[model samples]
Target: MTARTFQATNPATGQPLAPAFPVTTPQEMEALVAAARGAARAFAASTPTQRADFLNAAAAAIEARADAFVEAAMAEAGLPEPRLRGEVGRTANQLRLFAGVAADGSWVDARIDHADPARKPPKPDVRSLRVPLGPVAVFGASNFPLAFSVAGGDTASALAAGCPVVVKAHPAHPATSKLAAEAIRAAAQQCGLPAGVFGIVYEDGHELGVQLVQHPDIHAVGFTGSRAGGLALVAAAQAREVPIPVYAEMSSVNPSVFTAAALEANGAALAKGLAASISGSGGQLCTQPGLLFVPVGEAGDAFLNDVAAKLDATPACTLLTGGILNAFQKGAAGHLKAAGVQPLTQGAKPDSGAQPQLLSVPIAQFTPELADEVFGPLSVAVRYDRLEEVTPLLAGLEGQLTATLHATDAELDGLADLLHVMGTRAGRLVLNGFPTGVEVGHAMVHGGPFPATSDGGASTSVGSRAITRFARLRAYQDFPDRALPPELQEANPYGIWRLVDGERTR
Candidate 1:
């Protein structure tokens, strides 16, 4: 029997969106993976110029249909037009960036170590460059329907790296995913790429994820979601007969520390800054500052008051799903009632959306249990009296995407311990700013250790470095000059810079 089809619901109005999506059968999913494997060899062998053109085509397709894409995303995600439009722009820009990456030809990371024929022990000529790691399975995220969905960074980077992609469309925004998926498919066709260069499977069931991970053709996986979900995928990938790396962006509270000088210099402004971070997109951001560090004193007390006022004025955030809304409400209530956590502001009971909540907890009572991310527009203020306590508190933190510091010039010299501690805990460290906005540039790091990501040290899921995850270094030893990949050839056909015998050459 055919599997059931599902419809999407608008989080803002509890209304259903049109055009249901069917859950593909196990056999159908196998076909999708098989098709991707079939296309992988050709896609991986496609020249940098051809791959670059493919990305440009996809970006143009999304831009051409920006309205339809934005409309579907907004309706399903309940995000403001400005946010969705900005996301579309980011998505398009990143695609274009990867197109440039393919065009520039530097992502290959080529190196050549010439042979030393007259040595006591002869050294063989060796040349190497990054090669695509076959087909990859990507899981779209709920919070970012456009940028982290069908044609998001994972898909864009994988395609740029010459790996075929098979995305698991997040159920919360199936229509949006479908729209993005169609754009990608059309672009692939327009670029004369082989079939299954890009594909997406419907159905958010655990079994579907399991089937995809277990599939022998899938070389790797990319995911963005809750710790539980990411962990589940990691486990599934490990259980496979031949394990594959799962680059999963999971939980992060994105702790923000307010230095004593910062708290004293502009406590009110710092409070407002904290509000701004949690205010966006109903605070569903993975980088949301779930915990804020404040020094004990009148400044901390006043800052708490400022936070209460800020939250009271902030509107309710429409969550992506009813289940998320329910979970947010329960988490808020349970934490507020927890001992030593003093409630500062409780916006409203959970219903259609989440009301912002701010609570205060002293350092004496702060524990690993209390630092868990609330996953909504709620922020917690953890009070610390002594500077020594800061490192201990941060040391207890799980792997994080970002850890922010609101510091003044006067405080910088005195923050060594805090600095040392934070560097180990998060991927991106921010100063006098919020972590909500992640730039799509080469310098950005959107991954962290352990719970923040499955294997943060190995790869990133954003920016140009993201392409490296879907590729591996290929070494050609004692091979003919003509047999070497174009990137590693003697002539440097692409004219891009590479390391030759430990020295950079073009």
Candidate 2:
């Protein structure tokens, strides 16, 4: 029998792209996982400096092919050139940051204590360091095709943490994923890393994802997509003989709060910013401000109308796929059909691209449905009559990736309740800024609590901390100094900060 195959198409024109891949069968997948496991031991044994070399080479290789990748992403993911280029830059930055983490060596989280010869129980010499957790399985996201794809944060972090990785390519942009994967493979070969240190599965089968999670060799998983998809991976991984950590960045409506004083001071700018954020990237961003809470009165009147006018004037933009566009439309239409929700702007949608939409619901009529994420250029504004309504409304929100507040210095004092509410509900809080674009740095957080993510976002899938997800801790008791890993040695040759005898020292 002929083997099954998968094809990728241009979302804009529905044209096929190059390099169709045969579907990897269940038996083939097992073999692939086995190969990755074989490579993990050698890859983990290499020094951090050696791993950093691979990450730098991979980043350079990916950047060198930026033009070709941007073109493929344009066709397959319907992203504009500037956005795709920025995404490429973001991915490269993440790689280099992980490289720096390896060079610095502190990511190992080393802790050591000399043998307590005279202690009550006589504590032996115990030295512990973070170590790789075998192979990792990464699922590429449909949106941010490059930054979240083959050579993206998950791959970079796993490699940085000395773990082998096997990526499951997202079907929406199969050709783009293949190109990125090739660059990573080239870097691995150039660095003389073990075979199968990096691998990609191009099948468009649901079973492929489940099989990857259930694979015994895969010690952890990283994902970015819908709530349903993330949960499925979580469920499959836990049913395994050895359940592993799953860093799944899922749904968030990212609410922007507009205090009466801030709106009065900068109503026009807030309206414009909200308008740009709603339509940004066709609202495909997980951090898109899909919900807004505003105070009623004169300030609210002007802010709502101004936002409506700006949204009505914005042009249409296409989403990543037909499925996403349809789901977005259904969400917006559902709000229109619901009670007490009125259209702020009734502009018609184009046949291809999504049009900006704004709907308003009264505070008394606001439901959990009002806070649902509409993955297009859409937003819902809820008008509160009194300050009392603000607490209950915010309390009803699910854990989010971001919660924005457009408040002035004086307004902050009056918002003690709001400050406390948002602190626990979101991973990041924005002050007088939009949340559509996330900065790539050590302090940045791109994950949150459930339904926003699985495991309540204890670990991030981006930046330096991401490496910890693919690593486990190991302790050596009563081991000679000569036997210790360099990071945990008494001499501290690596010069990294580590906890020594209950104190932080080099």
Residue 270 alpha-carbon offset, candidate 2, angstroms: 1.4
TM-score versus the correct structure, for each prediction: 0.97, 0.97
lDDT of 1: 0.87
**Prediction-by-prediction clash tally:** 0, 0
In the range 1-506, model 1's lDDT, one tens digit per residue, is: 65698889999899887887898787888888989999999998898899999999999999988999889888898899999989999999999989999888888989999999999799999989899999999999999998998999999999999999999999989988988988998998999888789888899567897789879899999899988998999899999889999999999899888877787888877788788888788898999989988888888888878878898898888888888888898777777767898878756343424878888899888767777888888878889998788888799788899999888977788888888889999999999988999999887889987789999645788889999999988899999988878888899888988999999977
Clash pairs for candidate 2: none
Q: Candidate 2 at residue 145, lDDT?
A: 94
lDDT of 1 at 247: 93
Those runs of model 1 whose alpha carbons end farther than 4 Å from true positions after fitting are 1-3, 348-353
lDDT of 2 by residue, 50-72 (tens): 99999999999999999999988
What is residue 390's positional error in candidate 2, in angstroms? 1.1
Among the numbered candidates, top lDDT falls to: 1
